[model samples]
Target: MTDWRSDLELITDAARQAGAVAMQHFRQSPEVWWKNEGRSPVSAADYAANAVLETVLRSARPEYGWLSEETEDTSCRLERETLFVIDPIDGTRAFIAGLDTWCVSVAVVHLGKPVAGVLVAPSLDEEFSASEAGEATRNGVPIRVSRHIAGDHLRLAVAEDLLNRLDPLFVRDVERIKHVPSLAYRLAMIADGRIDGTLVKRNAHDWDLAAADLILERAGGSLVDLAGERLVYNRAKVSHDELCAATNADLPRLLRHLGLGLQG
Candidate 1:
């Protein structure tokens, strides 16, 4: 019988190895390139780390499907019940800029949801992992979300664009805002108590947020679209327009105050 836990362990190790490779090339003044309209950037480190992850993951489980930001989309993944969703070298620009915030992210998606996930940030010396049926952990220690009481100053972490789009009232009341480029690391920060919430808007991709989404949820936090709906994976479209994640229980009121409607 296949040991599902062992498979997760294998992938976790593979993700860390890929993260190490990424850290090696990050901040080395490498070449950067653009894709999909010259707005997004990819560096040599991203490809190098992606190559490592693809090789390690494929060799360990060739039967499993693959979906990665740096790789071409293959519809074959839609047929497999289990697939690897990865964002190797997430935060390429941060990495290139010598920031210690980039990471390698991996998720094992089964039946359209994440069953096991890992986020490795070598430069920051942090690694977060979770299983669908288990608790979230950082460097092997159990982690939980903060229970800050409501009606206090709400912390809202967001992309600069999303911050700019928010109504002035909401923006002024935000206790704090962090301008982090890496989506995965930002959500992980929410899990780590570095931030309280994140509001994401247009052009966010699945690979950018999948692993961290699970990490946040396992830490007693939540990830949802602006409509307060759960985020589903392995969809037909690769990008999302309005997604929000929070570590607070007052998320509904928070969304409403931000001028975004929420659903049940």
Candidate 2:
């Protein structure tokens, strides 16, 4: 098998390069277009960053298949044992709005699991990376999830709708973090101990979670469905259902409070 550590290095570098490309168009009012039936926005920076990531990562790992949000999907990836899954510029809306919460996310998935991943937020000067064989890191320093227990006033980056669904008593003790436009960054926050947990709504695609999922896992956290099953990637259907992310120490309580069964 290929060295997952090396794959992590490869994506970390590629993400950095792609992030730099995106920065050129950030806050510059780069041209924008709509996709997903006009529900989503795509900017020139997204495509430019995608181009850089495609060229750099693919050239270095031609044998690996490719799947990028900016690129059209293809069945060719299904034939390979390993592939690169990318979101050239995650949180395009935030980036276009001149916010610094967006990031360039990239990951290497092998046999339906992420072995390596990187998320670079250029505007924030933050770079998160992890491999199956290594601990999660931000800017080269090892990081882990927060160890806050359930009774504590846990900090959560969650959607308003989801927050309202929880028991009021449970909600009372929780501190709701302001909305973070980037789902990827929000999850990364949990990995680096910035928050206690978050609830992810349905319809999130692989590109949005794959890289950060691995990073969160390496940092002693998990991203799982309501049933507490961990996520799988690179499948025919890339989109995921509602999910929850938190450090292992707090995940069970979060799920319990949400009325979900314990994670297996």
- State which candidate has the highest lDDT: 2
How far out, in Å, is residue 19 in model 1? 1.3
Give the Cα error of residue 7 in candidate 1, in Å: 3.2
Q: Where in model 2 is the C-alpha error above 4 Å? A: 149-151, 259-264
Candidate 1 lDDT over 1-264, as tens digits, reads 233566568778988899888767776788889987998889988898899999999998899999999999978888898889999978877888899888899998877777888889999889998888778889999888766765656677765555666667777767767578788988888887767787776678889888888888888888887777877778778688777788757577666754443221
lDDT of 2 by residue, 1-264 (tens): 567887887888899999998999999999999999999999999999999999999999999999999999999999998999999999999999999999999999999999999999999999999988888999999998987654678898877766787778888888999999899999999999999899887799999999999999999999998778998888899999878999898898887866432221
List RMSD in Å for every model shown.
Answer: 2.8, 2.5
Question: Which residue pairs show backbone clashes in model 1?
Answer: none
TM-score per prediction, in order, is: 0.91, 0.95
- What C-alpha lDDT do the candidate models reach, one value each? 0.81, 0.91
Candidate 1 lDDT score at position 134: 79
